[model samples]
Target: MSDDELRELVHRVDLRIERLDARFDALEKRMASVEGRIESLERTMTTRFEGLETRINTKASNWVVSLWGATLAVLIPLLTLWW
Candidate 1:
């Protein structure tokens, strides 16, 4: 090929590469935004799960207390009557 043709071909390749680079940069920005959104969602879910766990623990404790109180009430009367 002539030197002038080779030079033109190189120029076209450089322009294509520049366009590709700009597209890749835009894609990277979009990916970062998506990652940020995912992280925010994860944090929100974690907070909600923690709140649910706390409620469950509170309910379990209340049930345990009620069961113990009922058992004591029944045993105390039985023991008094027997004595």
Candidate 2:
């Protein structure tokens, strides 16, 4: 209604806006920290899974080689006895 009252209202609104901005900035910082932690966890899990896959592949190869060796050892003796 008066110029002084209008000015006071504007000042109060400005203060509220500043406070809201500060809160948003703080929330943004916290979100960034949480995102960083999540990325780090994903990298660690990826490394662990890759290691497990390598171990499984190595074991499978070893089993295949052992199976072939055993089959040949048995076949050779039978062939020699028959001949």
Candidate 3:
């Protein structure tokens, strides 16, 4: 090919490479944004799960206390009647 044609080809290739680089940079920025969003969602979910667990544990503890109080009340009355 003539020198002029070769130069034109090289210039076209350079422009294509520059466009590809810009696209890659933009894609990297978008990926970072998605990652940040995912991390935020994970933190929110973790906090909600912790709150649910605390509620469940509190309910279970209340049930146990009530059961113990009822048992003692019944047992004490029976013992006094026997004595």
lDDT of 1: 1.00
TM-score of 2: 0.85
Q: Candidate 1, TM-score vs. the true structure?
A: 0.86
In candidate 3, what residue range of length 10 has the lowest lDDT sum? 73-82
Name the runs in model 1 displaced over 4 angstroms.
none
Sorted by TM-score (best first), the order is 1, 3, 2
> In model 1, what lDDT does residue 52 have?
100
Clashing residue pairs in all predictions, respectively, total 0, 0, 0
Which pairs clash in the backbone of model 2?
none
lDDT for model 2, please: 1.00
Per residue, candidate 2 scores C-alpha lDDT tens digits across 1-83 of 89999999999999999999999999999999999999999999999999999999999999999999999999999999999
RMSD of 3: 1.4
> Worst lDDT window (10 residues) for model 1?
73-82
Candidate 2 weakest ten by summed lDDT:
1-10
Q: Answer with 1 or 2, whichever has the higher TM-score.
A: 1
Per-model CA lDDT versus the true structure = 1.00, 1.00, 1.00
TM-scores for all predictions: 0.86, 0.85, 0.86
- Model 3: per-residue Cα lDDT over 1-83, one tens digit each: 99999999999999999999999999999999999999999999999999999999999999999999999999999999999
